[model samples]
Target chain A: MESMEADILIVGGGAAGFACALEAAERGATVLVLEKQPETGGSSAMSGGCLAFAGTEMQREQGIEDSAELLANDLKQLGGTDADPALIAAFATHQLETYDWLKAHGQVFSPALEASSGQSVPRVHTVDPADMVRLLAARCRTTGKVTLLVETAARRLQHDPAAHRVTGVLAEGRDGPIDIRARNGVVLASGGFSRNPDLVRQFAPDCEHAVFVGGAGNVGDGLRMAWALGADLRDMAQIKGTFGKHPTDELNNHSCLCVYKGAIAVNQDGRRFVDESLSYKLLGAACLRQPYGAAFQILDEPILRSGDNEVRILDFERRLEEGLFIQADTLEGLARQIEVPEEMLTKTVADYNAYVDSGEDREFGRKHLVHNHGALRRIETAPFYAYPSTAAVYGTYCGLRVDPAMHVIDVFGERIEGLLAAGEVVGGFHGNAYMTGSALGKALVFGRIAARTALGAAAG
Target chain B: MQVVVLLAGVVDPKWRLDRLGLRPGTELADESGLPRRLSPFDEAALETALKLRDADPAVRVTAVLPGDVGSDALLRGVAAFRPDRAFRFDTSGLAPWDPRAAVRLLGLAVGAACGCPDLVLMGREFGDCDDGVLPAALAEAQGWRFCGLAHAVAIADGRFVAHRIRGPREELLRLPPPALVSITNDRGNRLRHPLMKNVMLAKRGPVEVVTPQAGAIPRAVVARSLAVVPPPQRGAGACRILSGPVDAQVAELAAYLRARRQAAAP
Candidate 1:
């Protein structure tokens, strides 16, 4: 067995871990990062790299009039009543700083703000998550204060009982069991537990059997670690669902684009379920309401063409050619091919067309003012296309409860001294729904807070 | 001379822990629970096998996979590559098996069923475990010559010659009769993207099942467990893009590298 020591021991080298390591090391603390995979970049590396922030310097430069208060209010409203005001406030306040930090860290953001499904303002900034992770890893390597141990799995937390602090971690590496002692604090940036069916079943029952598209490394390690340390949990039932097909099979572009962009979602029975114009989190939950939590997004060629290349027709065409996308020229033909009810599908399409022509979505009250093809398209065009869609659950928006400073709390609402958390490990920031870019954004913000707090503790 | 190439399916090392431990689902969809494509290394092995089959019509390419019933789709996927015959070895219960145990079992089964192929082609290492020891173990078990990190291979004059990349050196070797060769990723032969027509045809191909002798192989030695901790996320300093002439950019890059190296030195 081998033993190592550091002033700050950050577990899980995904976006949060890397962010914390960089900040803590820059602040002059010796940082040790334990990564389970041969390479760094967990789920964050696999993401679309869309950072949704308001009042960013980039946004200001673009002359977009936005404020942190507005951003906070919008996030709270989008997330609904279950969202934590304090955490959301902290996130909004530090939103610009997070972007600045990323820019300072070698990440280049796109100038234009892309529209996400439910976001009110155009604030989605896209970058390559893999590139960001790579840049962070390279920078960490440059910092002499940081040491990265790859192919090492942190299994448990060793807490100081008298002091009620996380003192060290137990890990299994290629060499065997290794103990890593953090003189100050241990930050759990390991991602969510979507891959763990048992954990998903226990917490997010709605998406228990739903397929996942996020990082496989996110198996609820952070949540479990927090639980072991007696941290109180909240929003344990919240899970974010994505729209996709059986992940092992080829990806279907048409279905994903149509469903994500407000195309009518129908079951095999050929009936429209939920309002296509709802938020993605709600859409995912709605998709789960269908038969076996499986449905298809029905769209016409016009809508497909009008949608973004990445999210709409191009994705569908690619998937169709790859045998992942299922398509047909006629409504009846498609229904028969996918085993849906022809008459029901025809009626659904006809009714949808009626709604499109009138510019009034009576059933779902979908606003017709937006002109983007997928979400607000008129389904009057012929040669309709449909792709099988299902619930692809990512991380659960549930875990240990934390304060504004991101300190883990006990069941009695007492702060767990010397114990801090960030990223998906600490929930309640997101209630029933998550804000776009909030997961990665929160991971960056709280990870820094955790590091600074740990450094302060170490110095004391 | 007949040649047989063994195409083994390897999972992405990125999701190995989730696959073997917490996520008990056999489907790749179950691990990351996302749609997964074929492993690059396995695809390379398949490409090599197809090339060999094309070169020598008599040479039979057989894909031996140790998986369960859910692997039916995966087998169908491999068939898309146009192998002459596909064999699915039901070793699901023996999963998370150590490299040594898997190699020994595969050797015995190949010897009994396929009658010791003239040449066995395998990837240098599966992406998941990255043990990089399967070729040697299989070679030892079958009592055959072993060549590793093979980049190029060809059959000639009743023998097989292979080119291996050993660091900066390219070494060539010839093996007579029976031998095992491990293919490297950077090998000159590139894996071709499967055409849709081929994939459709593969879905309809017949896949034979070979059951290993009851308890004939030893259990795997290594035990894998999950690491509950997530990976670290360190941020990099912003990019300092230098504008001007190409020479100026190069100068800046050189200076940055030099400074980085100095900082890295203890």
Candidate 2:
């Protein structure tokens, strides 16, 4: 076995791992990032690239009123009693600085902000997810203090029993077994277990039929490794699929959230089920309960024209070009195309339009487009469209329990010294429902915090 | 029966190649740091070989890949399929653009990595650099019978049979031992996922490395320069929707169709 040493050993080279490495290197600490896949960016690259941040210059420049308090309050309101308030507070505290840190380190965000899920207002700052990871990885390499080894998978954590601390990691490199010692600590940021069917079945059996799409390397490596050491898990039962993925589209991993852009979701019976203004996570559960576990987002030319190509979920025209959206000149034609009753669909459209005019939704009581943002619009434009949608488990959004500093907590609620975690691997952040962009947001926030805590512990 | 599969992984097609250029002072394309996976054709060839092994317990399969350190992961991925032997031959200082030289080196690597085999398999294009020519060129140079675009391979009457499609027609060609088949991707030959246990074992196991003796072979062709060009833009016209009652819209659409037909009539 070949042995090496670094100040901090970060597992999984996605957003969290790269963020940790970049932060550690900037602080003059030697970091080694091990990525199991051939590529560095894991599920973070495949993500929709929205980061939820509050009180940022981008939001202020757009004249959108937002603050960290509002962001935290919204998270708790959506999360209900299951959310960990400490973790939410930690996120709200560091989110602004992290946003500045990313922008200072060359992370580019689009000018447009989208309102989805739990946002009180539009706060999603978007970037090309792959480019963001690549940028961080490149910066890490340039620091001369971070060594990133792709194709090296961390197999087991080396623990010092006498010291009660994690000392190193046993990894399998391209050549053979490699024993790498971390002088400071080890950060587990290996993403979620959506790709692991057995784990998904055990945790979320109802989500078995949901399409599994994420980083191919995410097979619960971090969660399982941490579980071996008696790490207490959090929010595992709250694992719900995200709505709006085209179940049969294999070429593209992105999901079209037409509902967020003023489209109404209709079941196979051509009737609206849910309010369509709730969190997509809640909508996902409702969608799964529908016939064939599928629904169609019905919209019009005006709603379709409101899409922004820069945002992956709102890229309606691109999906149109891919032939994923069914378009017709009339509701009757759309009803025939999507195989719904013409009279029911026409009546449904008429009813929805009447609700928009009367300022009241009698059926589902949908008052806004998505979450409390964007007024409801009448779906009466000339060209009508239908996007076939189903739920997809993009991330498990649940994993091991960790403190605000990202230290792994054991079943007994004691800190597992020198064992830290971040990213999707650390749960308790999103609680019962996920707000759009918060998963990626918490990954970046917690990753930098994990690095700081590790180095800060060593200094103390 | 001894079967050898020549696998050359390609850069993942899903990734956009922002930059493509030759390495400094070398004719080879600078592809370091780019992610690669087994191409569809390569997967078909390996799956075909696996199918043959599954049918006969006595059949021994060897998977050989020619690449640099970056390709080791691809070989490990093949090893997860649990072939009798899987190894990578050092492809440094070799130019894949030079077909004759590439064939010569590939032939030598195949011979050195695995002994004389009853059958050999490779992808249609061999690698991203070739234009569906290296497999046939190798067959011609080695005096072995060759079949191109084979979707599946099986033994029929003690001879290797290649199932392929040629010009929209399916054809099955039977060849004697020591024949080479260039496999093409198809639903029938889609690669199966390896067991997680086997994948873990393969990751931990040491990879077998082979360095083929690249003798001074004269190159018949030389690449002067290469340029990466973006694909042509496809401009889609805005959609025009015909509204109002059905009959009037149908009549207007029929008239437009008739005008187009008249304009197209020569």
Compute the interface RMSD for each candidate structure: 11.2, 18.7
Q: Which stretches of candidate 1 lie over 4 Å from their true place?
A: A57-65, A245-255, A260-262, A309-323, A368-375, A456-460, B1-266
**Which lDDT value does model 1 have at A279?**
55
CAPRI class of candidate 2: incorrect
Q: What is the DockQ of each candidate?
A: 0.03, 0.02
Query: Largest TM-score belongs to which candidate?
Result: 2
Best by lDDT: 2
| Residue A25, candidate 2: alpha-carbon lDDT | 90
TM-score of each: 0.64, 0.65
Deviation (Å) of B121 in candidate 2: 33
When just chain B is superposed on the true chain B, each candidate scores a TM-score of: 0.75, 0.83
TM-score of chain B of 2: 0.83
lDDT for model 2:
0.88
Q: In model 2, which regions exceed 4 Å deviation?
A: B1-266
Model 1: residue B206 alpha-carbon error in angstroms: 19
Query: Candidate 2, residues A65-173: lDDT per residue as tens digits?
Result: 9999999999998898889999999999999999999999998899899887778799989999999998888899799999888789999999877776889899999
Model 2: share of real contacts kept: 0.00
